[model samples]
Target: MSTFLNLLVYGLADGAILALAALGFVLIYKATSVINFAQGEFLLVGAYMFYTAFVVLGLPLVAAVLVGVVVATLIGVLVERFILRPMIGEDPISIIMVTIGLSMLLKALVQMFYGTSPKSQPAILPRSSVEFLGATVPLNRLLVILIAAVVLTAFTIFFRRSRHGIAMRAVADDQQAAMTMGISVRRIFALAWVLAAVSALIAGVLLADISAVDQNLAGFGLMVFPVVILGGLDSVPGTIVGGLIIGLLTQFVSGYQDPGLATVVPYVVLVLILLVRPYGLFGETRIERV
Candidate 1:
């Protein structure tokens, strides 16, 4: 029972981070209809930026976070403006190829600057354990869950109530109609990238806090694909549901089976989900008359 409880807590924390990463992916897809292969690289860049600021420059935690966010925002804007903007009307395959190139470029840049090594990440959350429901839960893990909840809630409110958020949704629904309504699709695209970058930044920092700052952080970001696919590629709420499911499943597999199996399980689930429901659990089904 205690083991199960521990796994539950750990899984939830992992899922929260997954959801954060996946949220950005969903936002970009919804707003731009473009799948960003470089989303994981964003996570890598954000984590490294935070590491440089906090560990290298010896800045306060808050300041380090701000630095990371600002840098990520800039990266988002630059990518959208310079790289993506030029290819706006290009073939989807070309856009995807460009993003793949972008990912490699970003990863190479990080490697060039930081080298391919793991750095000791300072603990931002309390590194203690607390008993919950007869289970010993790491205080840091609990704090991660709390922080992710707050951030997700804030995003949900923004999407539901804010004017810009409504415009974003409008654009996502129909670009032509949104344009007719006087909504700037280009501006929304930029905003989507910015939001995605910020979300990835937060997820990267939280993940680094739990683990170490390493190039493998980007690999963790790749796991967001399974989460978003499981939840629904364009469904924001689905990201949360998918994240929790994947997180719990990974934990359970690792605990009861081999830890190695946990790594393969998500992809396995991805395949099964694709075969059974390509649209995902909460993804909307589109029907077009050919």
Candidate 2:
């Protein structure tokens, strides 16, 4: 029983991180209808930036995180404006290819500068353990979970209440209609990318805190596809729930069966979900005009 509880706790902690990563992915998709394969690279950049600022430069952790987020957000905006926006009327495959190319290029650049070697992240939170319901949890893990929850909650409120958030939603609904309504669809696209970058920064920081900082950290963005699909591509709450499911399923599979199963389970689930509901759980059901 204690063992099960332990695995569950760990899974929840991991799910929180995945959810943060997926949030950015979802935001970009919802607003611009672009599946950003380069999303993970943005995360890598933020983590590396944090490492450079906090560890190498010996700046405060908060300051480092802030700088990383700002820089990453700007990069995101620039990518959309310069790279993605130009390809706007292009085929979906072309856009996807461009994103793939961007990911490869950015990753290679990072490897050239930071090298393929992983770097240890300075502990942002205290190195302490907390006992929760008979399970020992690390303070940093608890912090990650707490921060993820807070960020999700704040964003949810913003989407529901804020004008910019509503504008984003309008743009997502129909770009043409939104433009007719005087909501600059282009601006919304840029905003989505910027927000996506910010989310990546947060996820990168949490990931670095939990493990070593490295180029591989961006791979989490790829892993998050299952979570996004499970939650419903367009549904924010679906992303959170999907992330939790994937996290717990992977943990249980590895803990109870074999470690290899942890990685495979998410793929199995993704395939099944896609087969049954191609649009996703929260995805809008398309209507045929004919």
Candidate 1 has an lDDT of: 0.93
Q: Which ten residues in a row have the lowest lDDT in candidate 1?
A: 280-289
Model 2 earns a TM-score of 0.95
Regions of model 2 farther than 4 Å from truth? 287-290
What TM-score does each of the candidates earn? Answer: 0.97, 0.95
Candidate 1: tens digits of C-alpha lDDT, residues 38-127? 888898999999999999999999999999999999999999999999999899999999999999999999999999989887788999
Model 2 lDDT tens row, 198-269: 888888888888887987787876878898888888888888888888988998999999999788898899
Local distance difference test, each candidate: 0.93, 0.85
RMSD to the hidden true structure, all candidates:
1.6, 1.7
Model 2 lDDT, residue 30, Cα: 88
Off by over 4 Å in 1: 287-290
